[model samples]
Target: MNRFPLGVWLFALALAAVTALPYVAGALNAPSATLYSGAALVPSGAAVDYNSHLAKMWQGRRGEWDYQLLFTHEAHPGLPLVQGFYTLLGALSPFDLALTYHLARFVLTIGMVLALWVFASHFFETPSARWICLLLSTISAGWSWLLLFVPGATAQVGPIEFWLIDAYNLIGALFMPHFAAAVILQIAAFLTFEAWVRSAGAAWRGLLLLTALLAAMGIVQPYIILLSLPLLLILLGYYVISAKLLTWRRALWLLLPLAAHTALIVYQYVAINNDAVWRSFSEQNITASPDLLYYILGYLPFIIPILIGARTFVVDEADDRWWLPLLWVLLVAMLLYAPFPTQRRYLLGVQTPLAVLAAYGWTRAFLPRISAGRRPLLTGVYVTLTALAPALLIFANINAFAHPQMPATTAVYYSADELIGYEWLRGQANPDDLVLTTFGWDGQGSGGRMVAALGQRVFMGHWIETTRFEEKIAQIASFYNPVVPDEWRLMFLQNNGARYVWYDDSARVLGGWNPADAPFLEQVFSSGSVTIYRVRLNG
Candidate 1:
């Protein structure tokens, strides 16, 4: 129990509860007039992003083995392996989408907390240091939280302090399991490789574990390699040069898993690039890193201890364990600004290593210098300050749920009739059928994404997945406008090969044109204000 203590379990469960509570409460309290999406209320909350993931999960539920781009309408060669995580979940889930998603999320949340704790345990001798590291890594948001109060700061600064899920543990788990899974996989791979390095007789076991973890990563989010590979390489390089472990045969064994990871990633890249539709989606999916200052401020109190740990490591070269976390912190710091499109992905659980270093630094370096009585006081101050961002996150999420109609929440709802309309259309439309609806995902735009995610291919949805997002948005607006001639509308429908028109409450505000006025339209389904029209030949 000391190794995997009760405290970690308690801490993990508490965080998981915090993450799950608002969404559960929101669902229970939702009025019968509307169907709760079972997503947290939002400014970039669980629902918006998960809709895309839920789409993949929805496909899995339908027994579609291949990963199809459901957000955008196109016939492209789908992958059997890519993003198969959600697909796997969909296949395994007996519950509805929302329930399955939350259950998986809760489990993954607990797993992520435990994973971070285990990873930290390797570095810190005392449970106190490990626990402190866990707190810092999981929740320390720094001065970045202060930016939320600033009039224009969060937008200008990238909101890494509090909003970005990949930037922190609690938010990451709260957003989606894939985010936390990325971290989990990385820790598992690192530890497995580390074990392989130390164990002479059963080194083959490490290689096999590495292969499995990397393969799992391929399905979960291959972009995670943008962080994991460099750190592993650093470990390998240090071992080869400093420890003199570079007997060629042993080196080759270690190199094999690294090679496997690279080869799999390269193949995935080639496969994605081979598909025109998916390639376009990939090209549009850019997550460039924000300024370095954002990160420095975002990590706050942990940064000081991380630096102390680094200095101590540099000065002493005492513990090899210190080497890994210190190098991880430095490498990630540099990678955050690399010219790669997904540079910000390097932020994935970086705070974990930094927190490990911080705990090491404070206990080993800082504490001995201070008086014992004052040490607890200093630690108390540190914990309180570090707790700021996490406390704010909890408050913000709860507040959003309490006031569902707040500006931050947006149009995070679907009417009962709207869901029923989707159900009827899902039964009618084939897998490849194209759905045309207003371009908006939240607020004024039609819930085309909701339609798309529920298993139909929409004409356009999603910021990144949808090819030519702005152009399609304009074209969709024009298509919805009453002033547009039926000839143009007919041509637009035919040209895009859109099989169904989704006109819901939001779409109604865009234009009041009746489908009966159009010669090529046949009303196939209607529920209250929501209408589904099937395209037909004018003859």
Candidate 2:
């Protein structure tokens, strides 16, 4: 019996345990009031992305292919393969939505870590260096010392966004499915490429695997493929120049799969751009772009090590494998500054290659000078220094969960009864039926965005989703405004194809009119602070 298999299993179990530790603490020590108020134990506002996926999963179970991602304008393509797997598991044994979500996240996180370890092995022969790379990849943090010394830095730039940094693997894995999948696929692709480079017998097998992974990446997260293209091209150039057999003809042959992958990506974007609704929606929802200095500050841990590693590579031609990771970092950095809505998101899986480079720097540059006995102590010091910022961030998130600082209106607004209301709405309404509600963030009532997602129904939920958001919001306000005549309100609802109007405490604050008072609206359901009224189109 091989103990190696047992050892690997135990190691995986340990990783899972460590990964779940903070979440376990969060659940156990969640603010009593918040727990009672139906808030998720992890955090609020983090659910926006996860909720969208949950919506798709819910739809997927019903054999529906299209997802009404409320944050976007129209029904976007769902990750059927990913969602379908979960749906099948859900069918076999039921679990709480949040529990299932976290479980999936846990699996993906473990996969990412394992993939990073495998990828690092190609560049590093020493077990110590490989393990160091793995740990640094998982826990490395940004430069927070600069903020402490610089005047007004914290106030001007806000706290370091740990979620944006490459080393914050837990955040990406736990909260985002696409991100986790992309990370796994990206590393898997890299591993296959490396194997292809080294193998003589099964090189075609490696190419095939790499192509499948790249295509899967397109489906899992198109943006990842976009970021990966330049890096792949750089790798092709490296092989053409360095390898004897990798002549232009063979390199072009290698490029075929990538070219096809790129075409698919272009086609997907063209389809998105051609759709009037999706185009407007994506344009409106474009995230605020960050500056180069902001990116430098965020990835300083990896950047510093990579710079050192670059010098080592240049000076020593024997370690030519270093060129791959160096190119990866440079290409990704270029894409980060590329003019795009969500360029920052490309940083998700970069820690893998950076970890490799950083490990190289540590072993080649830093460790050679130290005595064997003293290396462990110095390594501890290096790791602690690297991990400082992430530790602070993890502590901040935990503290926020235990002693929440967000306003009650924003944090604990969604009660269990309200979620029940949304579930009930899902059961009652047709999937295509549009529900009209307030479109702004009032922070006082149940959000229509939640209703759109959890209810699995179409809605004029928020400005991000609704076309002509200001006008729609104003119209909704007028429809609920007590001063507005009942006839005008009725007309507005009919014009917008609104079959139902959901009113909550926030709605009352924004619009003085009550649904029960309108002759053209019939109260269908009422529970706690929520009320649902069916529009009396006939009347």
Candidate 3:
């Protein structure tokens, strides 16, 4: 019999299709005013980051690396691997950035499915168990539907709120490059390391492959390496203890990847300056460190199964195979609350191991106890019960496509004409030119993120970009505040290095000061309510 049954592949495909339906529908009927609004098909928190990445890739295609001048100080410094990956895609479709975005999404979706399957296969021996694990991995819930009405139930216990099955990984894989690529590479690394562990000391090939995988992960997402290294070490320690012999050569092989990872981390933090790397750490600082209760509730499904099968996993030498997943869950739980700004990121790539453990629990402890004749019926009922949360999650996500939430201003929130104006600016402006526009809210014409992303130029202000954020906001207020003297505004523009000013209905609403009032400013492009003004420094 094939180790991975055909049923597992079929189920994986089905799950992928189910999850992708909403995005496909949104793409076919994209929202008005935005190109590739298909990204909004799922309500992802990282939409802005992903959109910014696409813009950077587009800018890189045009021979410019520093894409988001407003967010980071230098060009193409952070997420080089992610930027390069999409840059290649953008080059393939030189004429259309939107097409490139969708193509990247497609690649991410396929890649995630394959990675999940490969990772799960390493832990599961039975096809049925693997299928169960795959399906469960795709769904999440904060509350159990069965206990919805009970007082202080899962829903009522706000303190215990957590993703029963996190759909973010699935949603992000389709839209977010940093998330999708890092997750894919993380799984590959885990698989490679597991192969080496199983090979004992003899498989030099596995060690080399593991080293390469860790290095690649470091380039894409160094934090993943940071979170993964301790767990790998624990696994290595387990092997050393179980063998009862001092295998110095094997110990060196295991330490090689960790050493490489440590070097990458040092270089990324110490060697690279002017990178505006802090944006990644600071922007999402508020939600970076979730509490321990949140994680306990989030992985309850797997936790219950692990607890039930703890003895089987501990005492039996045959149960050594189960140690990796258990260790992974424990390590992830500890790291989620670790004293780090990106603690929440450790949650990524965790579900696969959790799913495997849950499946093991179901087959070994739960299913066998039932009578043989009733097993199929009971299994179907159990599967349906397990799927309820994810099924609802999928439905809710699909519903969000029609009534999408307003994301951060940096996302694909601009109207088509506004985008056209930004495209025009990209062609006409120099690489170093800075544009002044409104700072907050995506309300009609107010947000100036378009210039920063599409035009590859600096803007006056952004919420996430901390460099001179307060100073720039004050300058922008003074320039746009109608009560301010025109002379003061002109001096402000000159002092701040702003060469272009974009005026749309948003700029008008925020600050009624019009560029036309200033003789030094010349109108360069106008379409409908939107107009671009060039600051003639000499005039």
Query: How do all models score by TM-score?
Result: 0.94, 0.86, 0.82
* Whole-model lDDT, model 1: 0.75
Cα lDDT tens digits for candidate 3, 422-532: 778868987567677665422212333463356345553345542545555566667778899888877767876778888877677667777898888999999887899
Estimate, for each residue in 433-529, the C-alpha lDDT of model 1 and write its tens digit. 8878665544235543464347677877677767777788788777768888888989988888888888776666667677667889888888788
Positional deviation of residue 409's Cα in model 2 after best superposition, in angstroms: 8.9
lDDT of each: 0.75, 0.63, 0.61
Give candidate 1 regions above 4 Å deviation.
148-155, 405-410, 441-444, 447-449
Question: Which numbered prediction scores highest in TM-score against the true structure?
Answer: 1
Question: Candidate 3 has what TM-score?
Answer: 0.82
Q: For residue 163, what is the lDDT in candidate 1? A: 58
List residue ranges in candidate 3 displaced over 4 A. Answer: 1-5, 31-34, 41-44, 63-95, 140-168, 200-204, 244-246, 271-286, 373-414, 441-455, 460-475
| Winner of 2 and 3 under TM-score | 2
| Candidate 2 lDDT over residue span 1-539, tens digit each | 24123444455556555556555655665443333222233333443444445555556546565433443224444433433333443344366555666676677776776777777677777778877887777666667546667787666554345435333564566455456667889888876776676666436777788888887787666777656787777776777686653667656656756976787677667765776766666676655435566667766776776676666766776654666677777777777767887666667777777788878888777778779999999888888887776566556555655654455323433455466667778789876566665546432224434542464454455445556566666776777778889888877777767777778766787767788888888898888878888988796
For model 1 the local lDDT of residue 140 reads 66
